[model samples]
Target: MKKIKIIILFTILLLPKLVFASNATIAITGVNTAAVGNNIKMYVTLSSSAAIGSWELTLNYDSSFLKLIGSDADNGGTFMANKVAGASGINKKVYTFTFRTLKAGNTLLSIGSSSLYDFDTMGEMTVRTYNKNLKIMTQQEIEASYSKDNYLKSLSVDEFEINPVFNKDTLEYSVEVPENTKTINIKAVANDNRSTIDGLGEKEVVVGNNKLNIVVRAQNGSERIYILNVNVIDKNPIEIIIDNVTYHLVKYKEYLTIPSGFEETTIKMSDIDIPAFYNKKINYTLVGLKDEAGNIYLYKYEKNKYERFLELKLGNLKLTPLSIGNKVLNYEKETIDFDGKIDVYKIDKRFKLINAKNILNGEEGLYLLDIVDKTAVKYDLKDIYTLRKLNKIYLATTIIFLSTTALSIIIMLSFKRKPKIKDKEQKVKEKTKKELPKDEKVVKENKKNK
Candidate 1:
């Protein structure tokens, strides 16, 4: 009973320490499992009641079973734990652990603290097992699976439907699983003689079961020989529409056929006539027929006349005289009658009159006389005559006006006389001579008295 009491006391003392020590809970939210070469990320949250001085985490796992391909811990550090001092004021600590998978299979991982000599604490917590699987099937395995199932023979595509097809060039098949199925795995392959023009390939797709319309296009131009094998929980038929045409698509496979009554005709144009100066070429409307499966086959119309124009080279005619004295004259010189003679006068004063009857018979020219009446009507150059008459009148009026004005000016300048002013000495001398001549007798008397 005394020993039992001692054990109880010791347990009581350890309980408080265990409760006060930091406890951690780790969980993976996004992806729990990773493929052979893929990465796995987990969120680590540590909870504690008492302040942690410094702590370290040691990750324990089977290296042989799983290899750590890569990791992004605190600064690319190794998977070993180091001092993680608890944050001030906050009682919990959290960290993220990201790692890549090198090998496959389940790996038992444990994250715990080292043995504490000075302080009593909880060591570590053992989390759940992490199971990793292979990434995907190889191209050869996918091809073989597709061949065995005869998926190629049963494959068919619809318009506007998203479906996985085999890519011969890349040797890969991509498929999306429907939402209704819990899980789905798909494999595909293609084999055709025109593999050079078309591609050949195989692929594997794995997805969770869901009712979703999956879209798969053949990469590397391998749409011709597409074969696919689908293992789905729900075996409902899938519908796909290609090129706006509808088709009943099966989950596993179906054959695609060009609908019946679908005839395609092409009209080849051997020659086409178009106006050279036309701005735009004629656009021919294409006519064709299509089936419910949305296959477009084109037909063209027969070539017809595109344009037309008159076939004539029109030009302007300019006539010039080669010789002088090309007098197109007539008896009535004013009018050169149609039967007139075109007198060709030479520079030697001799004239040769050629009957212009031929040239003037149908030609047109200016006429100075009325040929029909045979009347002689003087043809006057109105402007020249008027100007000459005006000049003569103006000259006569100017001469008469100028002569009269000159005579009047000369008569006024010569006949208009002004009296000259006499000098004061001459007036005085004349007065003295008059007075002396009247006193001649007294002068003689006076001289006799002197």
Candidate 2:
């Protein structure tokens, strides 16, 4: 009967102490598994039966296997050695910590000396701590369970509908938008959570057809592509003609930048408004022209005149010559080798063929303009013409001298063939003797002897 009375007395004395024990809890929650080099996030949550006014704790983790990069504790500041208060009337608080996995290893996240205070009384309360275990694996180890699903579960565009609806097996879709639309938003959800999708989000569109592609990469190293053929309508288009071929003005002017010393303006072409840039000092206007083959080129425009704009740079010298026609100068393009191809131009057929000319000094002549190398070499046309003339004069002079010498030799031979004065007198005497016969011959011989 005495032992029973002592047991009753002991139970009655311990009942109040058991009732005063804390009902607060603190636990860490996150993905327990991560691949090396990847980032992982963990949350530290604190809850209590009573409102939590404030709390302080030290988070501990292995620095070798993980590196803490960021945290959302204490208002984005470092959570170490700091006391933070919960929001008003809130009994629960969650803090996030981001870490980058370093290598293949296991790590634990625990807290130390954590004290929770009551919201009303500000009295410290006892709390239970729960640690979390994280396992980091190598890339090869994680690949064993990789899923091979490289397809999208759903595809959509913001404020636009895809034609023929969206199907996982259908890789191509066509969407049409108004000409004024500048951008389109794309949303693609992967079929599997392990798959990654690229080429999503907002993309700029042009006035014509725009081709966009989305690529899905499965965890097991496989890929699938989805194409979007987006066509933008052109309303009130501006058209122009060049070289007897028709072209349209580029409606999207955001891509082009106005040149220095030029102001934005608009011009009328084919009775339609066209955007252009103009400079009053130079009286030059530039516009973007698009060919039928979907190629864009800048053109110089004037009063009812248009030509392809060409600018050449050679070292410190820059030249903006008059309209150089597409017809290449065929007279002597290959005469002087510029070590590569040369663009020879003739402003007019009646003038000399030239590659470049100094507009400032009026030094107009032939030059080997190497556009790729940005080099120029001048050729002296005057010297070449002078040498040609000298050669012709030399040939003519030699011909005249040879003809005069041959004429003099012919005249001298004719004079030498004629008889001299003594030979003429001897010939006359002989003739007379033959005429006188034998009697006259004897009388002449006796007289010569005397």
Candidate 3:
């Protein structure tokens, strides 16, 4: 009986190892390949190598390149059987893993037992190859296409279409072209106060391309170089007008209106004018005019005529007293009509009727009269009654406040007084006598009375 029990205990202990050894068998069922940005799925199967009882199985693998996303080992065990005995023998387990490919290289996925008791059933598999491909573009090709469409669509370089005058301040001028081009070299000639300014000559530019930023700048007193763009591919003569003046014209549409504050005085044009039949039909003529101030106006002629008008209005006006002396001046109120726009009335020294300091410093009776729309609005300039009452009340209140403050200070100083040492000792002696015995108190009281 003892031998049987020992054997049973030993067997029971080794039973798990035996069962695990029978079930621990690993195999690389599938191999897969994937791109760098792609993924792959792998399936693995584990079956019992021999007949075995209940046992636990733990799987280990290199999680670097592959991952055990899911598993189903319960279906291979007793849980799926109607009775425990029906599932006691060899069983099979299935495992599914998903792996993400990283970089362009090879990686190995290994599977093995988690512990010594799990038995020596280990294997490994490799993903054949992982790769990635990248595509890139050049900068010059991108810039070339961008330049063709941006500004070259409406350019023309022709002999008869160029305007002679060049704007120095704004550095803008119009030129005629026979054909529209993406880029151009322009040369400008002008006098610089009877002296030539060096480098005030020629410049090149790329037009209508986003990569090139156009800027116009004056190089000398009278001459300016236009660093401009011409991206339009069209051959139509583009009319380039700067500051409302037609520099060049392929076709004229309308005349520039006179500025808000000026009037039209004259009209100037180029020496050559197309015939009357061609003139009215083509609407292409250079016209010039002047204001009252002699400022020149240049534009393309399209419509019949032009005119000018004023644009601004005057703001509010105010009159204030600076001072009212002993003698006051009386004047009649008047209205002034202003044609310009008005903002607000200012009553500074510029619009003062008298010195205001004198009115504040002296005792003088004055009057104010405001004139608006030819009507007189009158007001008294002094408040004698209110001033006298205010002065009396202020004086009384000041005196009362000063006296109360002084009294409070005196009471605080007096209350801070300290009792003398002699008085304190006397208090102590009286208290000691009252607390003594009856005979001692009577003796002390008799001595005190004596």
Best by lDDT: 2
Clashes of 3: 33
lDDT (Cα atoms) of all candidates against the true structure: 0.36, 0.74, 0.36
TM-score, candidate 1, is: 0.25
Candidate 2 lDDT over residue span 1-450, tens digit each: 999999999999988743343457889999978999999998888888887777787778889998888897765543533344555545787888999999998888888678887766667778888999998999888887688899999999999999869999999998999988779999989999989999899988766667788999999989999998777787776678888987778766774566555688887666766778876655668998866544566678877678765444556544444423444534443232232223455433333344454533435456645545666556676776898899999999999999999999999988886767668999999998888788777999999999
Candidate achieving the largest TM-score: 2
Clashing pairs in 2: none
TM-score of each candidate?
0.25, 0.45, 0.18
Q: Per-residue alpha-carbon lDDT of model 3 for 158-277, expressed as tens digits?
A: 332324343444333445333333234444333322333232223332221111122222232233233333332223323344557533321221223432223333332343332121
After superposition, the stretches of candidate 2 with alpha carbons farther than 4 Å from their true spots are 1-18, 29-31, 34-129, 142-150, 180-204, 214-225, 235-248, 251-256, 263-273, 278-285, 290-297, 300-450
Worst 10 residues of 1 by lDDT: 306-315
Q: How are the candidates ranked when ordered by TM-score, highest leading?
A: 2, 1, 3
How well is each residue in 1-450 modelled by candidate 1, as lDDT tens digits?
Answer: 999999999998888543333343432233434555555664444444543334445554466544554445455443433344444423455555556666655555555443221122434332232222333333443344332221232223221122454333332232344523333332223343222322222223222122222223333333333323333333333333445654322222111121122222233322322111111112222332222322322222224321111111112211111123334323211111223222232222222222221111222223232233332222334655698899999999999999999999998876554222346667888999889866898879899999
Better of 1 and 2 by lDDT: 2
TM-score: the better of candidates 2 and 3: 2
Model 3 scores a C-alpha lDDT of 0.36
Q: How far in Å is the alpha carbon of 294 misplaced in model 2?
A: 7.4
Error of 1 at 141 (Å): 10
